[model samples]
Target: MTVKGVDVASYQPTDYSTKGLDFVFIKITEGRTYTNPKWVDQRQTARDADLVTGFYHFVRPGSMTAQADYFMSRINLVKGDMLALDWEDTGVSNAEKDSFIKYVQKKRPHTRVLLYCSRDFWLNRDTTSFAGDGLWIAYHNGKPGEPGIKHPWRFHQYKTTPMDTNTGRFDDKAALREWARSKTP
Candidate 1:
């Protein structure tokens, strides 16, 4: 099985050789907390690692435009990578959700999007309008199986390890990527 990559935050090793990864998803911030102590020093950790690095925000379902503006302020998004929205149960309005996506696309036209959430959350979502947007689904387990979701996901965060600083060890990045590539437009 081909191992694709891993996601790390600012505190971990910035150098890539430690993991020999292909891609990385780094957390820039969540809500008003812009300063991650670990991310402060290793801002270019993923680039240094020679990995296809991407950034994501832990969103709280607010004014979509305001949230997008906040994200654009801090993140210097690299081209040819995804800018993900880590959605949680923040009781966000549907209008806000639509506006958020529209604003983000307007600001970063080339940026692909991923709507990430857990399986339970996915089942409970009202994301009918948000379909066709790429997904980075999170479902943690120790092994592989046919992922259970009514909606299709671009990638799945399956198989975890204790070594994770942000989340857990997702040992299926490569498989997820391959699946996403095959499925994505």
Candidate 2:
């Protein structure tokens, strides 16, 4: 069975659990400055709803270490919580992306780092330099397999209607749930 999940920012704070989502990835920070003001409440709500929770940082052009430090300082991740870097900014370089991923890994070796990028952006920007542990490919089209992505993706954001809909690569809900639970600190 495909495990359904949603990636949400401050702009989209509606309780997605009612929509039948099994997990959620919330945006915690953007660059080195902006923190989602609603993150605490949103996170609590998601947790209260028993949704497997994760956090993501929107990458911006700047010192990769600084950005990583900012993100790390803000998030309180445990084992089983997914961590991701949203690499949508075209201004960010491959080196910066690599540095960010490496810094996150060095700081939290137990946490799985996911790189979130669109298929078009990944191919156009040539983001093979990203060294995150998993991929969260965002392809708006219904089909994500046609992207020809060389990396094995764990999560695929295949739709944005109603909210961002995703499918995990796991074989069953139990397996995916086990994977999520194992990510805890």
Candidate 3:
């Protein structure tokens, strides 16, 4: 079976409920300049609720290492906490995405560093199909786990409105947690 989750950015409320979610991917940084204003409290809330927490960085035009450094230096990550690279910027190249993933992997060899992108981006822009540990695809098909693509995915953000809803490719929440800390996601 698949596990349900949500992804949130600074715009979302920190006091949101976790009644039905097994995980939460919170945007922590964008580029090297902005850090999600609500990250600390939102992350704390997820931890308090025992939801698998994930943090993502929105890529921008600049030094990949500097951005990684900026992102890594801001938060204290624990086990089962995922790290993802948001690849939506039109200016950032595919090579940069791969570089960022590689940089993060070198730093946290055991942690999962996922790639977040739309189906269009993956089909048209992607050249390497290198989504680090896994791909967190945004394909609003209403049917979760169906990204409509042959490429393997770990999480599917199958809907966006009413907040970005997702379904993970895990046997259950326990498997999700195990993959979060394991290199095999």
Candidate 4:
């Protein structure tokens, strides 16, 4: 049992349809200064469609705590909205990624925080298996939810079929919503 999702960025349109999607993770902030110009409308698009909403930050080389603080400050976060750290920037080290996740978790107790990274980074670069709530592996193939890593992942961004499609490790939308509220892996 799984739920379909998509991770959207500024380049994506604001009136993103959520016909068959259960959740959406929109890019909120990048580094410490940049915010996704379309995030508010994208979030509203998800909200109006009644899909579970998530927000993520593109991690950069900086103080993890400060970045986490800045990310938290930018979003009007609610308890059930998922949070993620997009660790695709080559400048971001494994330690910094983990630190940012940890800092976010510490600041917002009982909140779900996830790490989004490529397969190469997870396999070759990661030193600690320290994804906060679960790892959202970004490995695109014909198959969804098959990241090819042994890490106990909870989400898989399988392809960019027009949009970044994903599969969540859950029974259904109800279960995902319950888990999102609980912030459990």
- True-structure RMSD, every candidate: 4.8, 2.3, 1.4, 1.4
Off by over 4 Å in 4: none
lDDT (0 to 1) per candidate: 0.58, 0.79, 0.92, 0.89
Q: Which candidate model has the greater TM-score, 2 or 3?
A: 3
The C-alpha stretches of model 2 lying farther than 4 A from their native spots are 127-131, 144-150, 181-185
> Residue 55 CA error for candidate 4 (Å)?
0.5
Between candidates 1 and 2, the one scoring higher on TM-score is: 2
Query: What tens-digit string does per-residue lDDT give for candidate 2 at 1-185?
Result: 56778888888865545356677889999998999998888788778877777899999998898998999899788667778899999999888887798889888887888888888877788546464777788887876343357767788898888677777787765676577656433
For residues 1-185, what per-residue lDDT tens digits would candidate 4 score against the true structure? Answer: 89999989999999987999999999999888999999999999999988888899998897888788888998777768989999998888877888899889888777899999989999988999899888999999859878899989999999987999999999999899898898643
Inter-residue clash pairs, candidate 1: 10-38, 10-39, 161-169
Off by over 4 Å in 3: none
All candidates: TM-score:
0.73, 0.89, 0.97, 0.96
Scored by TM-score, the top model is 3
Question: Candidates sorted by lDDT, descending order?
Answer: 3, 4, 2, 1
Q: Of the candidates shown, which would achieve the greatest lDDT relative to the real structure?
A: 3
Q: 1-185 in candidate 3: lDDT tens per residue?
A: 99999999988999877888999999999999999999999998899989999999999988999999999998888977999999999888999999999999899887899999999999999999999999999989898988988998999999988899999999999999998877742
